[model samples]
Target: MSIEEKVTSIIVDQLGVEKDKVKPEASFVDDLGADSMDVVELVMAFEDNFSVQIPDQEENNIRTVQDAIDFIKENQKA
Candidate 1:
């Protein structure tokens, strides 16, 4: 799967949300009903799945699904 697809899948699995609802612009908290703890878990999942370290400052900026996708795409090791 592509990075976008993988990131969306992780968001769906992490938030228990329908795939259709995980739009690129959707906010994890405002749109997907994720709590702070859920966001942390999602970040951890992303790090593990993509094999990248997401610093706390960067993690804080990942409010949308696209944000996660972009971060992984930019930071994933070859």
Candidate 2:
């Protein structure tokens, strides 16, 4: 699967949300109903799946699904 597909899959699995709900513009907190802990777990999940370490500061900026997808595409190990 592509990076965008993988990121959307991760968010769907982690958040227990519908696949259609994993839109690029959807915000983890505001749109998807994720709490702070959920965000942390999601970050860990992303790191594990993509083999990339997202720093603490960068984590805060990843509010939307597109943000996570972009970060992974940019930083994931080949």
Residue 75 in model 1: shift from native, Å?
A: 0.3
lDDT of each: 0.94, 0.94
Residue range 1-78, candidate 1, lDDT tens digits: 999888988988989999999999999999999999999999999999999999989999999998988899899999
Task: List residue ranges in candidate 1 displaced over 4 A.
Answer: none
Q: Give per-residue lDDT, candidate 1, residue 72.
A: 91
TM-score of every prediction relative to native: 0.97, 0.96
RMSD, every candidate, angstroms: 0.5, 0.7
